[model samples]
Target: MTHRRAREAAGDKDVLVLGVDVSRQMLGSGLLDEVHLHLMPVLLGAGAPLFAGVRAELLPLGEPVGGAATHVGCSVVFGP
Candidate 1:
């Protein structure tokens, strides 16, 4: 869904997106409020970077929840 559609569908609720390109679009367009990153142990080389075209911004991460994968939550801070 486009950002407007996503916003309308997600009124006063959270939307979990699993696609990298979609996430990039949301983040770049300043449509994301927070980000939760699930880091796994295994790595498969050759893929698009998460923050590829997004501008530099500070993302203060909260305490990580660990398990088979580590989950880290970050609040998106927009603008200088």
Candidate 2:
């Protein structure tokens, strides 16, 4: 999914991109939310990356306040 979708999926809070390293023998995994899991297909031959350049702003989740079903978390807004 696109970053905007990811942000929307993540709710109204800001989205952060965490750094993850993967090896040819190791599996690559990503987390979008508690409901979804992000994974990439296996590549056996010499190939290029699925994504070229990605630019993102850092947004920290400051406070979380809400009920079990809904939440309003404090986040530093950063984007275009």
Candidate 3:
């Protein structure tokens, strides 16, 4: 089954994270209400790339929030 199709079969409300490659393939394939990401401080030399193929825009969620990067939760804006 296609990446998107498989994800759909998994049912909605399932917060799934695909690899960069799979994400790229499944990008823009389904409707996502909101995506939450925990922005953690510290960066690795190399790691999997998120949103490599995602086309949705990311907007901050909740009140005006800013931190040192220890941990930050973000919301992604879906749809045009």
Candidate 4:
């Protein structure tokens, strides 16, 4: 679905999007308020690149919560 359609479909509920390309599209859509990223330590030799086509923007992050993986919270900033 397109971003506008997704936004309309979402209403007031939070939607979690998985995968790099979709995430990039969502980030560019200006419909997200915040993002939670789960960071794990592992190495896969070849894969899709994160932030491959994302524009330059600053996401203000909260202090990370650590566990088997680190959870980071960030608020999206939509303008230059």
Candidate 5:
């Protein structure tokens, strides 16, 4: 889906809902212009799936973004 449609589906002003991609051993976030709420429960277990596509460059939320995944153990990474 296009990034613009994604945001309109999210319907939020203060928060930017993008995409989160997860592979066999890697997790990454994307900065799409929008995020589709309809796809929240969708999961791709093969290869590196695209969480979202953005037309512009994605900006990082901070220097270091840390998080805890129930299945991935401890993970510390940056977001864009």
Candidate 6:
């Protein structure tokens, strides 16, 4: 589901939805304009597939933006 549609469905101005992870069915619905991924460089033998639905290559947006999580950020194409 697109962010706008999800927001409208919930009838709330602020709605947090999960866009990543393999479980999510919607990824490249051509609804979003941009997609951000803050990932840690690690090799987990088994876990939730990263960018399972993400097809486009990620491009660095700017300098490393850090938060509670230590990760390297990249921007991926959201739509055509």
The lDDT leader among the candidates is: 1
Location of the lowest summed lDDT over 10 successive residues in candidate 2: 22-31
Candidate 2 structure, TM-score to reference = 0.23
Q: Return the clash pairs for model 3, or none.
A: none
Cα lDDT tens digits, model 5, 1-80, are 54457567768753443334422112233332322222223455653444333223334333433344221122233344
Model 3 compared with the native: what TM-score? 0.44
- Estimate the TM-score of every prediction: 0.78, 0.23, 0.44, 0.71, 0.25, 0.44
- Candidate 2 residue lDDT tens string, 1-80: 55658778989775655333221111122323221123345545675543233222324354334343333332222224
Q: List model 3 lDDT by residue over 1-80, tens digit each.
A: 65467667888647576455555445466445445555556676776676665667766566545575433335556555
State which candidate, 1 or 5, has the greater lDDT: 1
Q: How would the candidate models be sorted by TM-score, starting from the highest?
A: 1, 4, 3, 6, 5, 2
lDDT of 6 by residue, 1-80 (tens): 65667768878454544534522334445443334555566646665764566556667667666675555545556534
Compose the digit string of candidate 4's lDDT tens values, residues 1-80: 77677768989977777877787777776656777788888756676675665554557586889999999878877765
Q: Return whichever of 1 and 6 wins on TM-score.
A: 1
Q: What is the lDDT of residue 55 in candidate 4?
A: 58
* Candidate 5 local distance difference test against the native: 0.36
The true-versus-predicted C-alpha distance at residue 56 of model 5, in Å, is 2.9
Model 1 lDDT per residue over 2-45, tens place: 66787689898877877788888888888787888888978786
Runs in model 1 deviating more than 4 A are: 56-58
Cα deviation at 39, candidate 3, in Å, is 1.5
Model 6 gets an lDDT of 0.53
Candidate that beats the other on TM-score, 1 or 5, i.e. the better one:
1
**Stretches of candidate 2 above 4 Å error?**
20-80
